[model samples]
Target: MSILDDLRDRGLIQQVTDEEGLEKHLNEDRVALYCGFDPTADSLHIGHLFPALMLKRFQEAGHRPIALVGGGTGMIGDPSGRNEERSLNEENVVKEWSNNIKDQLSKLIDFDDAKNGAVVVNNYDWLSQMSVIDLLRDVGKHFSVNYMLAKESVEARIEHGISFTEFTYMLLQSLDFLRLYQKENCTLQIGGSDQWGNITAGLELIRRSSQEGESAKAFGLTVPLVTKADGQKFGKTASGAIWLDEKKTSPYEFYQFWINTDDRDVIKFLKSFTFLPLEEISELEKSNTEHPEKREAHRKLAEEMTQMVHGKASLDQAVRISQALFNGDVKSLSKDEVALGFKDVPSFDLEESEKPLIDLLVEAKISSSKRQAREDIGNGAIYINDERQTDLQYNLDDKDKIDGAFTIIRRGKKKYFLIRH
Candidate 1:
């Protein structure tokens, strides 16, 4: 299948400016395409995977991919999906975020010196140098006030309020497409469905700025906005946004996010988020339908995504920790693995000593009182390091610690506690 066909099969394509023309252009030449990412945060989150991976898809199809860092546009912020106007970040902060976003993009595409190697460009390089007068004359004149206001992005914010800085954002993005088309021979721009307006604006700018007729012009495509079957948003967990950076969200945590995907969403996510072949995904889909409890699709999606975003070593570590936790083999986990497994569980810090299990349970608040703790312990309801302890005098010591850093306690089947020394 062609690249566009594959995208359609994956349900990635939402809207395209010129489907037939764009298909012919892609098939006939080594087209250059660009996707702009606004650096609103230091790290790109799970929400960014679609377009980031789309760049890789194009590169794999022998096309050049230009990952545009919105250093200039980011300062003004895109008002596409927001309910209110965004508070602008400082130049220094946006600059730092731009650099971080560049690094994140590098992880998703090949930047090696080859024919189809990806290239990273910052809009600030050109946009920052243009004077306000030059912007108004060169780019601003192309966009009419009525045309700008008609866009969904601006229209949504009209009642709440939209600032002039935000109102002029379409011009800046259009300038990006125009500049890329002129300098890099870029002919296509892609982004999320929410960016359809911006993407088309860029295409309009490309046509208006060019001396060529309809035979030669830029195009735009957008991936569908992700949604959940349960009426919740994709890429969100109880904790918050799942970031690409390991520091913001650990590999284990990220893995858990995918592994826990609702069954209804897993197969769709496997299609959209993973590079696995259609045949393999079909087999997994069949397995999922036959045995939903096994959750084969969920495991595959989690494994593929975790390995892609984090390295093999990190994915391996995450799996090791997950398996150990699941098997009740908590004692076998290393110190770092313990930290990752119990990072969010109830925890307490205490000095190491030969404290009776009942007293420790009471102190850790695993039980309401010493009497209740002793009663639970006598009934074999308390466990240390996954081992049942029925003796009321059972004491926790250094030997009970996992790698001498922490101890895991289970008050019942579902409740887990972590004690640090």
Candidate 2:
């Protein structure tokens, strides 16, 4: 199957400009495509996974992918897909974030291209050099205020308020495309569905900037906003984003996130996020129908993606930690391992003065009341660092330390608690 066809079969193509024309363009050898990511956060979250993975796919399909960082546009804050205008970030902050994300992108794409290799560009190099007059007279003339205002990106905020800086974001994005097209012949742009308006603006700028009849029309493609069947956004836990950086999100936390994927969204997620072959995914789906407790589908989904984005070592460690948690083996863990493994478990603090262990247990949310805490201990429902503590008189000691940092507490089989030192 063609790469585009494969993407469609996997439900990656939500919207595209002229499917036949795009197919023709893609059928040609070595098409150059790009997708821009903003430096809104220091680390990329799961939401950025689709576009990054798409870029990798394009490279593997004998195309070049320019993974551009929005060092320029991020500062302006495009209001696309947002309810309100974003808070503008400091230049230094954006630059630092942009650099960090660049390092992260290196993990996924091949940047050392002699031919059809990936490229990373920081848009700041061009945008920073433009004076107000050069911007207004040169690039701004191609875009009409009516056309700009009507775009869903800007128009959606008309009822509220849209800042001029944010409204001009499309122009900045278009300039980046024009610059890329002129410098590198990039012919396709991909992003999330919210970027449809901005993508078209860039395409139009390319058409206008280049000579007519010689007009090199570019294509725009987007993925649907990742969502759950219950109509909530995906890739977020109560703690916030599931980030790509290990420091921001431990491997154990990342594994647990996918292992806990809502049953309603698992198959869809397998299709969307994973690069596994259709036949293989279908086979796993079949197996899941028979024995879901095996969680075969979730396992493959987590394994392939976590390995692709993180590394083989990380995926292995995540699986090992998961097994340790499931087995409730304390001796199998070290101090750092304990920290990374129980990173997401609810944690509480203790003072030296607390007495009876029951009061402390109730305060740590292990039990509803002191009486229940005592009852739980009597019945052997509580554990410290995976060891069952049946005695109500047992108090924490330095010997119980995991890495001299914290203690893992368990209420039942699945629920966990952490007491930090």
Candidate 3:
């Protein structure tokens, strides 16, 4: 199937400027497509994954992909999906973030393919060098004030107020498309649905800037904005946004995020996020319908996402931590696994090497009082490292520590605490 057909089957295509023409363009020759990612933060979040993966999809289909880091436009901030203006970051800070995002994109797109290797470009490289006179005379002349104000991005903020810096963001982005077309021979620009206006505007700039009798063979496509069945936003949990950087969101946490996908959304997500074959996904979908309790689809989704983002070793560690927690076999987990698994659990630091279980429970606030601690122990309600310790006078020693660093304590079935030494 053509790449466009594949994307349509996965529900990835929300809008295309000219569907028939774009499909013909994809089939005619080796097409080079581009997607822009603004470095709004040091690391891209899950929200940025769709476009990044779109670039990967095109690359896998034997097309060249250009990952554009909007170091210049990032400083100006795209007003596409906001009701209020974005705070501008320092130029140096934006430059640093641009590099960081470039590194992350390197992981998602293969840059060593020799024939169709991906390229990363920073828009700041050109946008930074253009003087005001040149910008106004060369590029700015193509856009009119009425045309800029009519765009949804600018129109939405008319009442609330948008700065001149943000108002000209579309022009900057259009300049990116035009520049890429000239330098890289790029013919397509893709982004989220909110970018429909800007994407088409870039097409306009390309067409208008073309030499006499020259046709600008450019197209714009956008993927739909992801939404959850429950009406809550995608990629957000109680903890916060799921970040691509492992330091911001650990592999274990990231795995758990996909593992807990709602039944209604699992199949749709499998289609959207994974490169798994349609046949395999169909079988998984059937399994999901026949035996939802098995959660086979959920596990597969988690495995695919975690491995893709964090690598196989991290995926395995995440699965190990997950299984250990689910089976109440915390002792089987390694020291690092324990730390990751119990990261959100209540924790207390122990200065002493050992302490009586009763006193430890009281001090750690696991139990309200010494009497309650003894009662909990006697009733077999307290556990140390997933092992039942009914002895009232049992003392936690170095042996109780997992890897001589942490002790996992459970007061009952689900409530857990971490003791750090």
Candidate 4:
């Protein structure tokens, strides 16, 4: 199947400037395309996966993909999808973030292929060199104020107020497309739905500036904005945004995010995120319908996503931690796994590890008082490392510790506490 057909099957295509022409262009030769990502933060969030993965998809299809890091445009923040002005970051901070984003993109796109190897470009390299006169006379003159104001990005911000800096963002982005098309032989530009206007503007700039004029084969495509079935935002949990960097969002947390996917959205996510064959996905869809309780599809989604982002070792660790917690076999987990598993659980640091069980319970706030602690112990409601410890006189010892660093305590079936030495 053509790449466009595959993307359509996965529901990735939202808007294409000219579908027939693009398909022809793609089939005629190994087409070059690009997707721009602005470095607005130190880490790229899950929201970035669409375009980044889109680049990967094209690369796997034997096409060249350019991953553009907006080191320059990031300073001027795109007004697309915002109701207010963005606070600008310092140049050094933006540059640092740009580098970090480039590193992350390197993980997603293979840059070593001899034929269709990916390329990472920073707009700052060229955008910084262009003077204001060149920007205005050479590029800005092509876009009129009336045309700019008519765009949804600028139109929406007119009532709330928009600065001149933001008003000219489309022009800057147009410059990026023109520069890349000239330097890299790029013929396609893709982004989220919000970037439709900017993408088209770039196409316009390419066509107008080309010696071939309107016959320049430049095209634009945008993917749909991902939304949750529950109407909540994608890539967000109670903790915060799901970051691509492991330091920001651990592999365990990332695994859990996909594992907990809503039944209504799991198949859609699998189609969009995983490279699983469509036929296999259809079977998974059948399993989802016939045996929703088994959650086979959910597990597959989690496994694929975890392994893709964090590698096999991290995926195994995440699965091991998950299984241990589910089976109430906390002792089987390693020290690092235990730390990752109980990261959010209530924890207490022990000054001494030799206290009586009841005293320790009271000190750790697991029980209201010594009397309650004794009652809990006598009632078989207390456990140490998943083992029932009913003895009222039981003393905290090294045996209770996992790897001699931490102990897992349970007051009842669901409430758990971590004790650190």
Candidate 5:
């Protein structure tokens, strides 16, 4: 099947500006496409993964992909569907985020000069230099205020009030595309469906800025916004954003995130996220019918995505940690491993000296009250490092430490704890 055919089969095509035209363009040698990523945060979260995945798909299909970081546009946050204006981050903060975002994006797309190698660009380079008059006379005249205001992004903010900084966001963003189109010969832009307005704006800028009858034209495609079956935003847990960076989120937590994908969302996610062959995925799905409890499909999805994002070693580490936790073998992990493995697991820290097991248990809020903690220990519901602690007087001492470190506690069958050394 052709590239567009594959994209269609995989359900990646959300809304392309002109499907026939775009397919025709891609049939040519190495279609140059670009996607914009706003460096609004220090690390690219799972929310950013859709575009990156799309870019990866395009490159694998023998197209050049360019990633644009919204260094300049990030300063004036895109007011797309925001109920309130975003707090503008400082220049230094945005710059640092832009660089860090670049690093994160680098991990997702290959930057080598082979395999339709991806190129990275920052909007700040061009947007910072354009004079107001230069922008208005040269690019702004092509778009009417009426057309801009008609967009849902702008119209939604009309009642809430949008700042001049935010209102001009499209202009800055459009310039990124125009600049990349000029510098990299990029012809297609892709992003989340919310970026349709911005992408179309960039296309208009490109169509207008070229010389009279200049044969320069481009297209826009957007992926659907991922939402949970539960109607919650994707990429969010109770703890917050699932970052690509390990420092912000552990591989263990990341692994759990994918493994926890609801039954309704798993197949859709596999299609959107993984580069797995369609037939193989279909067969995997078929297994669900034959053996429901295996959760084999979910396991494969979790492993593939975890390894892709966190590398094999991290996935292995996470899996090993998973095994250790499942078998109630807390002794199998060292202090550092325990920390990383259970970072999201419920826990409380205390000095080994001041570590009254009751106080620690009460403080972790694992137990409802100090008396309850004592009672639970007496009831044989309490475990310290997987060993049932029958004594209420069990003051945690260094002698009971794991590698001179923690005492894992459990108040019930589900809850877990880690005490510090």
Candidate 6:
């Protein structure tokens, strides 16, 4: 199937300037397309995955994909979905963020140039050099004040007020598209549904600036805004945004996020996030309905996404940590795995003296009171490193410590505690 067809099947396509024309252009030539990402943070989060992965989809279809880093536009945040104006970041700060984003994209796209290799470009390269007079005479002259005011991005912020810097974000983005069309022969721009206005504005700038005038082949496409069935935004957790950067969110955490996908959302996510074929996905969907208890779809989604973003080694570690936790096989976990598994669980520092496991459980507050702790122990509901401890006087030793750094404790089926030496 055509890449566009694949995206449509996956429910990725939301808005397109001209569906027929885009399909013709994509099929007739080795079209070059781009998606711009603003560097608002040092690391890209899961929210940024749609466009980045979409670029990969295009490249796999034998088209050139240009990943545009919005260093210039990022300095003046786009008021696309915000109710209030954004605070401008320092020039150096935006530049640093731009660099970090570039590094992250480098891993996702194949830039080897073996066959239509991907490219990363920074808008700051050209936008930073353009003078105010040049911008006004060349690019700014094409956009009418009424036209800019009517766009959804600016219209929403009219009540609260938006600064001139942010108001001009669309123009900067348009300039990026125009520059790419002129220099790189790029004919398409894709982004999230929120960027439909900016993408179309870019198409407008390309058409007016081109000799083709109104007949320019420049087009725009946008993916649907990711939303969950539970009425919450995608890519967010109780902790906060799930960052793509491992340092910001660990591979294990990222895996856990996808592994815990809602049953209602699992099949849809598999279609959107994984490169697995439609046949395989359909089979998984059938399995999802037949054996919902197994959570096959959820596991596949987590495995595919974790491997895609974090690499094989990290995916393995995530699986190991997850399995160990599920099986209550704490001894199988390494020190780092222990830390990753119990990172958010309650933890206490032992005084480096021998303490009964029951005392430690009470001391760590895993049990509400000494009576409950004793009762839990005697009932064989307490576990020290996955081994049931029925003896009320069981004491923790250095051997019980995983790597001499931590000990995992389980009080009953659900509660877990960590003890650090």
**Top-TM-score structure, candidate number:** 1
Which ranges in model 2 have alpha carbons more than 4 Å from their true place? 212-214, 346-373, 392-399, 403-406, 413-415
Superposed on all Cα atoms, model 6 deviates from the true structure by an RMSD in Å of: 1.3
Candidate 1, residues 1-421, lDDT tens digits: the string is 8999999999989999999999999999999999999999999999999899999999998899999999999999798999888889999999999999999999888988565656999999999999999999988888899998999999999998989999899999999998999999999999999888888888777777788845556899999999999999888888999999999999999999999999889889998989999989999999999999888899999999999999899999999999998898988889999998898999988786778788889889999999899889988888899999898877788889889899999988889999998
What is the C-alpha lDDT profile of model 3 across 1-421, one tens digit per residue?
A: 9999999999999999989999999999889899999999999998899999999999999899999999999999899989988998999999999999999999888877576767999999999999999888878999999998898888999999999999889999999999999999999999999999899889888888877213668899999999999999999999899999999999999999999999999999999999999999999999999999999999999999999989999999999999988887877878888999988999999999979999999999999999999999999999999999999879999999888789999988989999999
| Model 4 lDDT per residue over 221-339, tens place | 99999999999999999989999999999999999999999999999999999999999999999999999999999999999988988899999999999999999888888898899
**Worst ten in a row by lDDT for model 2:** 349-358
* Stretches of candidate 1 exceeding 4 Å from the true structure: none
Number of the top lDDT candidate: 4
**lDDT-based ranking, best first?**
4, 3, 1, 6, 2, 5
Give the range where candidate 6 is weakest over 10 consecutive residues by summed lDDT.
110-119
Q: What does candidate 2's lDDT look like per residue over 1-421, in tens digits? A: 8999999888889899879988988897678899999999999998998889899888888899999999999899989988788988999999999999999998888898776567899999999999999999988998999999999999999989998999999999999988988898888999999999999999888888887523576888998888898777778888988999988998778888888887777888898888778888888888888888899998888888788878999888888887887887765777777778777679987655334567768888889998899899999888877888898887777766676777788887878888877
Worst 10 residues of 3 by lDDT: 208-217
Model 1 weakest 10-residue run by lDDT: 208-217
Once model 1 is optimally superposed onto the true structure by TM-score, how far is the C-alpha of residue 87 displaced, in angstroms?
1.3
* Residue lDDT tens for model 6, 327-397: 76778888999999899888999985588877787789988888998899899998888888889878888
Overall local distance difference test of candidate 1 = 0.91
Candidate 3 RMSD to the real structure: 1.3
**Candidate 4 residue runs with Cα over 4 Å from true position:** none
Compute the lDDT for candidate 3.
0.92
Query: Global lDDT for candidate 2?
Result: 0.86
**lDDT per residue (tens digit) for residues 54-135 in model 5:** 9988888889989889898888899985889999899999999999999888888898866556788888888889899998
